[model samples]
Target: MKKNVLRLFVVGLIWLASCSPLTRVLKNPDINEKYQFALEFYENEDYYRAGLVFEDLLPNMAGKAEAENVQFYYSYCQYYQNQFDLAAYYFKQFYDTYRRSDFAEEALYMHAYSNYKATPDYNLDQSNTTKAIETMQDFMNRFPKSSYFEKAGSIINELRGLLEKKAYSIAKQYHRLRRYQAAVIACDNFQKDFPDSELKEEVSFIKMEAQYEYAKASIYTMKIERYEETMEYYYYLVDRYPNSEYMKMAESYFKNTQRELYDLNP
Candidate 1:
């Protein structure tokens, strides 16, 4: 009974504090009073309320000595509150609204990172991932000399790898279905589109397998010719990956194809 009474008392005090005249004074029309209250809220880590107060003063304080700091802190407030979408929006706004502001570059980078932070799992829609990659690319193009350029480039590479993985996964699905022609074409397209991707080994392996499958599905009368073509693919793999386990498999396949050709022509 005592604990219940204590809880009730605490809840009532919180309600009264929210509705108090002091709350009004802090959020009132006086700029200095509002600014001071915003500072207090920010210091107390009440970011949502602090962001609200700072946003209210931001436009009016533009060109004032405190504008940049206010906007910067306001953006951070949103970030700390886990309001990443709002943080991204405000950070981009700050980047666009301020020229020659000290935090401009950081704001731009954080705008991209904010979107990246909101990226979902790879199985989900990649809309935000694509947006983050584009934004980071834009940042790099705009500020080639900025110290953040390398970091941004690295992020782009990581995002691109995610896209590459998606493509590889879909292509492998086609392979598993015995859609050899489609799988071959998809892997070829992927290599053409993303030549610098880290999935090069996987793509090459898939391509060789797809070609071999196509060859294997041929009629016995045509098998010799088709196997010869498959041998060419295997040879390519051997040349590219001398030490790969796939290379050993390819060499075995090539020798089998050569002996079959000899037997068929004999």
Candidate 2:
């Protein structure tokens, strides 16, 4: 108990020592002094207090040369605090207001990167993901020789992969729910949208299976056409991936579909 009490006392004293400077600066009448202390806090990685000090200095520093630095560092404060949406907003604001400033290029990149960090998982809404891609693309177009160009390309590819995974999941979900017609349509759309996806084999199999199931449930007049569509998908799958892991199930569906077509034509 004595040791624990001593440790707590030491921690409390350190906390007070740290807080005193910020408290004194906030009360100081000299704006320059406060600005210097804010930069000190920011350099020391004390973003929360630095943000407070910077926020206080912004209105007074307007039209002064210090305003630009204050705005740039304030956006970084939000970013380091993981307030990504707010970071994106402030970073964009900084770049727009200081287009010719030395930090403008970095600020614009951070704006798009903040949106990328704000994007949700593959299953959630992806509006921000799309926005991040567009903003990053704009950055690349504006600064083709930037050091951030390669990194921006990588981010776009990763986000596109997320979108592809989401699309594939939705198509699979439709198939799982026995919405075979919708599943076939969704699978076709996914194929068209992501022609080079690694999931193409599985998607092709699912499309074929879904079409076969739909044909099985259709009326006599529609069964032949639907089954013929299934055969086309199966052939495409086999032609592209003859050694696919899904070939066994795909062949079973193909054989069953062919039997049906034969029965209908006979």
Candidate 3:
């Protein structure tokens, strides 16, 4: 009975505290006391309320010593709530406003990283992906010795891979659809754009296959020249990828093409 009474008493006191002046702080207009309350809410991990409180405090706290802390935590409050757009905006704003602050480096990293989080799949629009790479690279250039340098480089590589995947898929799709001319153009463009891609060997095979198909489909007057072009690409593929997975398929093209060329003269 005594324990139950004690629990009831504690609960009532908590309800009164929350319902009274403490709850009214959010509604209060006094700027100084409000800033203190915002800090208190942040310390307690009430990020939603903290964010609202910080928003209110920002206009009042600007040009004051408390402004830096308010701005810093405001960004974090948005971040903790997974509001990445706002987090990115505020984080960049923080660094821009307080470049000498201790939080500057972290703010910049999070700004770029926040956008990275919002980036969609490779097939989607990649403006955010582009932003991430550019911002991370800028961060690296500006802070070459920064501890985040390695992490930034890793992110840039990951974004680049996403771009490569998109380009590879588009070219491969053209090849698959038997649009040989477009396939040749797309594969060539993909190679130029992503010269370092691991898909280079596969792309080489695609170009060879596309050229062979184009020659076979060409008018009689163009067949000989086109076939010769296909053979040239075949030699290049063979020299570069002797043990390639697509070698068997390429060999089939070579045999067929050779028979046609011989029959053309015969």
lDDT tens readout by residue for model 1, 110-135: 99988878877666677888998998
Instruction: Rank candidates by TM-score, best first.
Output: 2, 3, 1
| Model 3: per-residue Cα lDDT over 1-266, one tens digit each | 99999999999999888786557887788878898888888999988888988998888886899899999999999998999888999999999999999999999998988888878899888888889888888888878888999999999999999988988888888888999988888888888988878999999999989999999999998998888888988898899899999999999999989998997878
How close is every model to the real structure, measured as TM-score? 0.71, 0.85, 0.80
Q: Which regions in candidate 3 have their CA more than 4 angstroms from the true location? A: 1-23, 215-228, 258-266
lDDT of 2 at 186: 93
Q: Model 3: clashing residue pairs?
A: none
**lDDT (CA) per prediction:** 0.82, 0.94, 0.89
Tell me the tens digit of each residue's lDDT in model 2 across 39-148: 99999999999999998998898789999999899999999999999999999999999999999999999999999999999999989989999999999999999999
Residue 81's C-alpha lDDT in candidate 2?
Answer: 96
Give the Cα error of residue 13 in candidate 2, in Å: 17
Worst 10 residues of 1 by lDDT: 20-29
Candidate 1 backbone collisions, by pair: none
TM-score winner, 2 or 3: 2
Runs in model 2 lying further than 4 Å from the true structure: 1-24, 219-221
